[model samples]
Target: MTQAKATSGFLDQVCWNSDGLVPAIAQDFNTGQVLMLAWMNRESLALTASEGYAVYWSRSRKSLWRKGESSGFQQRVHEMRLDCDGDTVLLLVEQQGGIACHTGRSSCFYQRFSDGGWQVNLPVIQDPEAIYK
Candidate 1:
């Protein structure tokens, strides 16, 4: 019997850490804005490419999970890139439905400190329950 071919081309080149994980940065393809940063193991990487959605490994949770799985806001991948060192991944994505952040903001980096303290740059686009439910 013929062996099945692996679709994960260049995956062997990636530099996974001692924990078998790599950092993944999600960015907006259109806006060139960074949405979020997360970690991914081999399984998450394969799942993200195959499933065509952003999947990541949660270090704290110690499991695999699809981004926005519990939320209605999903990130459809536009492109996946590897950094020069091949230790990091950049995922250009187009978010669906609503904001990407759990705080209901468009991005996690919506806060900017002015002369003194932090300030909210953008208001919450939707309620957490609305997207999470």
Candidate 2:
């Protein structure tokens, strides 16, 4: 998070899946908000540590994606953590522009399960079209 270099073999220490990816969760450091969930390959995780930003492996695109590269709302890494099993990664970050979800909401986890139904709990801070374009 401090632009510290990821040690060699550090990526290997993570328990990678058969697909060579790990589940990554990004949280707002200041507000304790769960910003988003993503996937990170070795290279993306390494790059994220070295670059001090959120970089994820896009399963759909089959490529690495730097978060907010186009939306101008990059996540600055404040801390990186691994679950006890070492299969999941948690990143405490300062979210730029207060937007994390591609849908332009504060977080990807905008749904609440209540009354035996799923309800939207968060409002979109900005429209996707407005953010992406």
Candidate 3:
């Protein structure tokens, strides 16, 4: 079958939220470390499937965000899966540049809950200022 046909079938199964958005999680393909969580609209998800990379809906900007378009931290997807309820997407990817979080951390989930508070347990892999600019 054509790629479009395959993608269409997959997209039909996703249970998008009221805003027509679904939560997408990016995880390390090898280590299974969750890198970040983003949202995807139909267009972004379709683009991701066709392009073989990560594309997310930028809620703040109200636009499609091609991952690594600026910071060069692209996510090359190895596999994509839907949750049991079909409301979430999981992308197993090879994160480029070793940074997944905009803050330059390897993963966005760097804060750990401990001692009745949240603690930063991971060092920044690179300076955000340097990465963005």
lDDT of each: 0.85, 0.94, 0.92
RMSD after Cα superposition, model 3: 2.1
Stretches of candidate 3 exceeding 4 Å from the true structure: 1-5
Candidate 2 TM-score to native = 0.97
Off by over 4 Å in 2: none
- lDDT string for model 1 (7-120, tens) is 776678789999999999999889987888899999898878777789999999999978888886788987788999999999989888648899898898888999899998
Q: Between candidates 1 and 2, which one is better according to lDDT?
A: 2
**Tens-place lDDT digits, model 2, residues 34-124:** 9999999999999998999999999999999999899999999999999999999999999999999998899999999999999999999
What TM-score goes with each of the models? Answer: 0.88, 0.97, 0.95
RMSD of each: 4.2, 0.8, 2.1
* Candidate 1: segments with Cα more than 4 A from true spot: 1-6
Residue pairs with clashing backbones, model 2: none
Candidate 3: lDDT of 32?
A: 92
Task: Please report how far candidate 3 places residue 103 from its true position, in Å.
Answer: 0.5
**Per-residue lDDT of 93 in model 3:** 93
Which candidate number would show the highest lDDT if scored against the true structure?
Answer: 2
